[model samples]
Structure formats: C-alpha cells, structure tokens
Target: MAQPNAQDDFAKLSADLSTLRSDVAKLTETLAAIAKSEGGAAADAITGRLRYGAARAEAAASGLAEEGYAALQDAKARAQALGGDLGATIERNPYGSVLAALGVGFLFGLLSRGR
Candidate 1:
C-alpha cells in the first residue's frame, strides 16, 4: 500500500510539472507577439515625429536665411547711400575734408603712440 501511494504522488507531480511548462510556454509566446507588434508601432511613431521635427527645422532655417538676406540688402543700400553723400560732401568742401583728415591722422598717431 505504501509503495502504491508513493507512485500515485509521483504521477501527480509529473502532471503538475507538465501543466506548468505548458503555461510558461504560452506566456512566452504571448509576450513575444505583443513585443513584436508594439515595437513596430513605436518605431513608426518615432520616425514620424523625427520627420516632422526635421521639416520644422528646415522651415526655420529657410526663414532665417531669408531674413539675413534682406538685412544684408538693406545694409548694402544704406552703405551706398552714405558713400554717395560722403562723395558729394568731399567734392563740395575739398579743403575742409583735407583738414579733417589731417586732424584725424594726428589724433590716431597720438593714440597709437600711447598704445
């Protein structure tokens, strides 16, 4: 009787182990499927966001470039206007312009000597 009882217990333990293994395998399969599906979706979402960000950056750079070009054009126009004014002034008062230049040169010499 004792031997028969021990055999019965061993058989029950084997069945329990088999069931546990089957449950573990099913769980592993479910996890793998979930990871595969979710990983692809997450990757696609990240790629979309990156593309949007790149587009925004490109637009911002283009806008800044346009603004810089406009500013350069304005600066060139102003410099040309100032050059014309200076040329007219020099032509109108050559002697005064020469005297001013001599004075500026003297001042520069004095400042440079100190340096």
Candidate 2:
C-alpha cells in the first residue's frame, strides 16, 4: 500500500533522465555534421593548424632520435680515433675493466636472483 507512491515517483524520475540523455546524444551528432560542412577559409585555417601541429610533432620526434644517433656515432668515432687498439687498451686496463664488469655482474645477479 505504501510502496505505490514511492514507485510512481521513481518511474517519473527515470523517464525524465532518459529523455535528457537522448536530447544530448542528438545534439552531439548535429554539431559533428555541421563542423564537417561549411568549408571556406575558416575550414582551411583549421586544416592548416591541424597539419602544422602534426608536422611539428613528427619533426620533434625525428629530431630527437637523430640527435641521439648522432651522439652515439660521434662517441664511437672518438673512441676509434683515440689512436690505440681497443683490444690492447682493454688488456692494459684490465683492472679497471674487471672492476666495472664485476659491478655490472653483481647488478645482473641481483635482478636474476628475484626470478
């Protein structure tokens, strides 16, 4: 007996909410179509802006990668041009290399130990 009034209120609220959601969906679709049409300088300006943004992003990414590769190549060239056989240098600098190797090996050992 007491449930009917509460149930009626809940039903009305649900219907109102449902109608509002449908109206918003229709508005979104209408705006999307409008933006697609009406081509002119305004449209061209938008297209140009989008293209410029995409090109700038692409250029930045490529420039960063090229800079990194160039730095690596320069470092390799410097090592080769230092006027000593790399193998002989390693042999002469065995103590330093061995210490570095041991440190690296310890790190790898710890990482693998967890697995």
CA lDDT scores, all candidates in order: 0.97, 0.88
Q: On a 0 to 1 TM-score scale, where does candidate 1 land against the true structure?
A: 0.84
Q: Lowest lDDT 10-mer window, candidate 2?
A: 32-41
Ten-residue region with minimum lDDT total, candidate 1 = 1-10
Model 2: lDDT of residue 92 = 91
| Model 1 misplaced regions, further than 4 Å | 1-4
Candidate 1 residue 2 Cα shift, in angstroms, is: 12
Model 2 accuracy (lDDT, Cα): 0.88
* Highest TM-score model number: 1
lDDT of 1 at 23: 100
Candidate 1 global lDDT: 0.97
